[model samples]
Target: MHIVIPIITAVVGIIVGAVIGFLYRKTVAEKEIGSAEQEATRIINDAIKSGETKKREAILEAKDEIHKSRTEAEREIKERRNETQKLERRLIQREEALDKKSDAVEQKAEELDRRLAKVQKTQEESEEVRAKQIAELERISGFSRDEAKEYLVSTIEREAQHDAAVKLREIMQKAKDEADANARELISIAIQRCAADHVAEATVSVVPLPNDEMKGRIIGREGRNIRTLETLTGVDLIIDDTPEAITLSSFDPVRREVARMTLEKLIADGRIHPARIEEMVEKSRKEIEQIMKAEGERATFEVGIHNLHPELVKLLGRLRYRTSYGQNVLKHSIEVAHVAGILAAELGLDPVPARRAGLLHDIGKAVDHEVEGSHVSIGVDLAKRYKENPAIVHAIAAHHGDVEPESIIACLVQAADAISAARPGARRENLENYIKRLEKLEEIANTTTGVASSYAIQAGREIRIIVKPEQVSDDAMVLLSRDIAKHIEDELDYPGQIKINMIRETRVVEYAK
Candidate 1:
């Protein structure tokens, strides 16, 4: 039992030694960790101090830069202020100089007024002396001032009238000579220089067939083909009485053209059915539009008129199917343009505007059938709607005398229209009616006042009237001619213009004769 007790004591002593060694080791480890933490804190404090120093340096630099900028701005402001003060001083000096010049001018004006007043007083005195001299002379002549003045005025008026009559005769003679020669040369040159394609009025359009057998096909079962064609084309189809040719008749030229094209296309396709006819008609209408556009472009190019409104160009193309009397309207328009241009050039006018106006003058005829008014009125309205120049609108309206001509261009347009229409073979009229009308016009002129005799000349385009000098004075003859013209205009429905010539002669016979 004693051995066991000593063993337990030895174990107890060993346990105590182990516990003290563990405590010492733990204490040393704690000391080491504290030293490491203090060293880390010292390093962090140094880093923070370095960052603060950089921030302070940046702030100091920013403040210094701001101060520098302020100093520069102050210097610039001072410089600008000095410049403004210098400019103000110069302006003050200029104003002082202007004031001095104004004062000098006012003084000169006052002196001139004083001098004018003195001159007026002198003139009054001179007038009084002249009046006394005139009164003495009148008394010596045994005539009062009023009577003498009346006789002098009468004598002067008689002499002046005689001189004026002589001068007027000379002026009229010169003007007539120049005007006649100019008109002849201009009209002749214009006619000769312009060459237009001859196009006759076509009442019937002919469509050529590929073969004789096709004509039979065109006249389908029970005449259904021809009936459908007529119904679709709005034209009468005369399929018989011709070999390999069919006639399309329509009063409207545009309809006739469309019908002709539609038939030609249907024949080429060898398809003769109602459905085919409708399709072909529609296609032909489109083709006609394209042709119309192309023709319009061609006409504009030929006339050298550009930038026409698209609608205006299309209307111009429509003139291709229009006829005036017997002349093709498109060709006639081209001719008129040429004539108007030549005449305008000779008259020292702008030829392009004149030519353009001429080309478009008859454009209203294209739409006259569809529209309510005469072509002139329609054309004027159209031109105005398109924002055309007022002169151009005036020319359009007055070409037919539907409106009063306001410009020289308008008169030129009327003259060109007349020349175009009056040219031989340009138009056709009923011979019997034309002759009867001319006879009636002559009869009417002969029946007018101051109409001693009358004769129609120039294919009844002009009438020459002889007047009795005693009954009709020179002034009365002028009035008589105007009256005759008005009567003719009101009484006749002539295609073109008619001129009236009134002749009054006064003969003074001498023994030498």
Candidate 2:
């Protein structure tokens, strides 16, 4: 029991001691916390004071910055305002100057208008005076103003024409001395050397029949034979009352030739049937083809031109049957080739190409009747098709003056063609055409101003114009001739150059009282 009591007391004592210790620790903790809060309060108070000092410094700095910025802005504003005032003053001055200029321009314009009105009034007054003077002069001279003006104009025109004629004569004389002599010599030489024969052949071929009875045979069994022949050969058989003659007419010489040959063969064979006519026509076509080929070859050989296309050679041969104004085209072509070659030789150029071009210059004429274009165009196309030289093609195209001749060979071909066609006896026109040509020549001269009388002499080759001595002076005669010649060249299609002769005779035939 004693031991238990002591143990309880000890335990109570230990509990008391732990309670005291706990209380002491709690008091110490509160004291330490209170001291720490006071230290934190002191630090916070110092921070507030430092913050207040820094805020005051910042306010002072901001105030100073605002004052400096305001000062600079005011100074800049004043400068800009001063500049704006100066610009405004300059604009006002310029406006004033522009207004002064406008006023001066207006005054000058008014002055000019006033002067113009004064000048117009003066002109009207002068016109009135001129009208009065003209009326008085017209009354005194017994000539109207229009008639007097016409007379004055005529006089001026005559004088001007005389002066122009003098100038033209001088120029022509100079040109003749420089170029015409050589040109004339070359043309004459070429023409003389190219002496080709020409026989007048027409589109109609006259095939002699054995008897008039043969006409019935040719007409043949309801005209079937003639129809077949014409159909085969593209020729017209004119069976007329002409004794022992049958005319084979066709514009195409090749067809006419074929028809002629067929008729001859049928007559000789004594078998006048449609089938025989067909066979004969076919055979004649072949024969004509062969003849053409031979002629083409002959042309090439004669021209001394080689390497021609086969088709081109055949076309050349076809030209053998063609005619131009009753002149054999093949002969003309051959002559042109010769003349062209001679001219080329004289010009110190290659003659072979010139001759070739001249020979083929009229190549288109061979197929012109069958084609739908001019001979020049057809010839150019054919030459191009045959792959001829470009120079030769150009010559062919330019031979008829269809195109400008650019190459020497082309010009030579042109000259040669002109010479061939223009030489004496080279071509002939029908009587009607000849008379029309002469009449046209005379008419041209007669219609010319101041022409007193005119006559076409030398078979329409020369036109003699007798001018009025008072109207057309001696100096004007040269210009009149030139003008007339130019007119003839432009209007007429003659073979050769025409001669224009101007005769001005002034005889002062007064009465010998």
Candidate 3:
């Protein structure tokens, strides 16, 4: 039994060993298979991860390409849209401009057609009228159109000439008669109204002394009195040259008048001291002022212009001592006022205003030495300062034509001034200058372009210029007269005025035997 047990145990041992080896082999194989499976799984997983990565990259690239294409398409679409809009705007503007052009062309064509139709109608009417007139002319007077027209024109011209000659003669005769009567009336009225003393020559004012011995008193200790008198009066005192008589030498008439009154007072008082001299001068000045006021009042009353400032009245009175071109200023002003009043009444104007303007027209002469401008300008300023009417100021300024006349009254003032200055004996001129001015007047008239004869009449106050009818027309005669007057005014200086007459005559003579 023992033997059998040992054998079995060995067999079991061998079997166990074989099983162990087989199990070892099986484990090895399992490890190898697991390793192979793990490797394969790793390779497959790696390939899948790489494939997904490639696929994702390809998708991203595709998306990027799609975005680029979309952006390009959008840019191209925007360009196309912009181009389309520009074309539409251009087309719309072109269409509007074309419509305006078409309308303008149509209007022009309509206007042209209307004008052409009117012209055609006018031509047709003119042709019909001309034909009718020609036919009528041919039927009448037994003449062709041109011959009948000539005959009619000649007949009318002859008849007009005969009628014009008769009418001209009658008109001239009537005009002469009327002019003579008016002249006579004006002269008689002017002479009757203005009867002032005729001043032949300027006289030197003399202040007589009470006694010959008073002249020594006037001389003073060292002729201080005479020197003071000369200084004060701006005149020379001839104390030694005459006995009981003194001569006042001054260029200014006003100064001479003042000095004469002062010397007369001093002689009457018999006090020849400087204080007495000054007092006498002051008294004389007051007396002169009073005299001026009285003269001004008289003038104003005469002129029918009463309302005036006391100062203005005194100034007007001073004009009594003033002269212009040897014409008394106050007298001239009065005459001008009268003439202006008459003219204003005739012209339907207010005579009071016109007369006032005329009287104050020469107010500048009172202050002319103190003021710088022309008398007209000075008078205008004075009137304006005194709150005179604007029309009156304008008349004062325009009376001498220094300014443009602003009204009919201003022109009337000028006319009155001229008339007053132009009256005979109203102003005086030296004999030599008078004769020379007359000769110059005749010479100037003869120098006219169409003058055939010239004559200076009425003491050189009027000039008559005869012009050849062929050389001078009726209008030319008027122009020539104006030119002559202007030339005389520019070239000559004389008192009063020179009247210019341009006469043109056309004479037709035929021998009747």
Candidate 4:
């Protein structure tokens, strides 16, 4: 009983301690909860202050931005207003200026109208005066008003014609002076550039024999050898009294050359048979052909030309044997080419075509013996056949002034040809023919109207026509000169060209008063 009581007392003490412990834990928990509530309230207050600060800052920033935008807007509006006011001021000034200009124009128009009215009144007064003068003139001169008016009109027309003639003379003289200078310079340049040697070709070929015995051997077997040679070579063998020389005469230079070579070979070989003669002639022919080709190549090389048709080259070489009025045709062609090229270079034209045309200008002479036409016609046909440029063909045809020169190249070719042929000893003309040519030139000029006298000078190179000043006005002198030139060109067959000069002067004789 005693042990149970003690145990029950201990149990009661333990319960009391447990109760105290529970109360202590509850108090601590309540204090902690209260602290947490205080902390939450403090945190909520701090958040509210932060939010207010941010809102106030944002509001201030928005107000500042709004103020800035409003300020900019106001500034822009002020600037626009200023610009608009300036534009309006300018517009108003322009309107005022236009108004002034309009007023000035109106004043000028009014003045012009007044002047026109004054002019009309003056014209009326002048018409009355003119009518009274006409009446007086008709009464005094025993002429009607119509006759007086016609006489006055004729006099005015004469004066006008005289003035117009003088003006025309001045213009023509100025233009001719400039043109003549340019032409003279170009021709001089061409002549200076072309320094070709003159080759005086002839229709006869003289072969030097070893002895006079060779002449008899040449005419062997009762003139059978000479006959065979003439028939084969188409040339005349003239056995003249000249010692150690035989003359081969033929109009065809090629045939004459072939005959000369054939005779020379026969003399050298001392084989006088017909068979050997034929063989030698054939060899001579082939050799001459080769020489012709070589000459053609040399000519092209010298002239700096290339790409010629083989047949054309051969024909060009044929010109080496040809002659026209004692001038070597091939040499003449080369000279003409040089002159033409020089002229073309000076005149700013292509020298190649000019040179080519000039080289082939006398190509017709090569085949003229075979063809029945003028060298110009034959040359044109040949050029066309060779597929040459039309300008080149025209140049060839017009080199002799046979056809009208249609281009500058053709005109240059004509001038070059003239210069080439006009050189001293370049051509042969009998004294009789030369005198006749001069007389014909003077006659052509004298037949023209208003020509007092005509003189052909410079070996008929130029004709000077003196015109009566009273009959020929300055303008008429120009026309008369042209007409005479044209007529001379049509009627006369001249070498190179002829220059026609018309002289007209009024010499008023007045002694000192």
lDDT tens string, model 3, 1-513?
A: 999999999999999999999999999999999999999999999999999999999999999999999999999999999999999999999999999999999999999999999999999999999999888867775798778779889999867766766676568669979977875565456446655545523434778877888888888989899898888878887765676898887766677788889988888777789989988877887888889889999999988897687777887887888887688888888887887777677666788888888888999998887789887888888898888888888899888777788887887678778766766666776788778888988888888788999999988777888899998766456556767888888888654567777788899999999
The order of the candidates by lDDT, greatest first, is 2, 4, 1, 3
Predicted candidate 1 versus true structure: per-residue lDDT over 73-184, tens digit per residue: 9999999999999999999999999999899989989988998888888888878988888889897988888998998999898677667666766786799799889888
Off by over 4 Å in 1: 1-172, 197-219, 238-247, 268-270, 450-457, 464-483, 489-513
Question: Global CA lDDT of candidate 4, please?
Answer: 0.87
lDDT of 1 at 192: 82
Candidate 1 colliding pairs: none
User: In model 4, what lDDT does residue 419 have?
Assistant: 85
Per-model TM values vs. the true structure? 0.59, 0.67, 0.58, 0.69
Candidate 2 lDDT over 1-513, as tens digits, reads 999999999999999999999999999999999999999999999999999999999999999999999999999999999999999999999999999999999999999999999999999999999999999999899999889999999999978877888788899999989798899888777767776775544554999999898999998989998898888888899988899999888888989888988889999999999989889988998999999999999999988999999999999999888989878898889988999999999889999999999999999999998899999999999999999999999999988777888999998988788878876676777899889989998998899999999999988878888899888777867867878888998889776578888898878768887
lDDT per residue for candidate 4 within 314-407, as digits (tens), equals: 9889999988777888999999889989999998888998899889899999989899999899989988988888999989988877778999
Q: Write down the lDDT of every candidate, Cα atoms only.
A: 0.84, 0.89, 0.82, 0.87
Select the stronger candidate by TM-score from 1 and 2: 2
- lDDT for residue 209 in candidate 1, whole number 0-100: 82
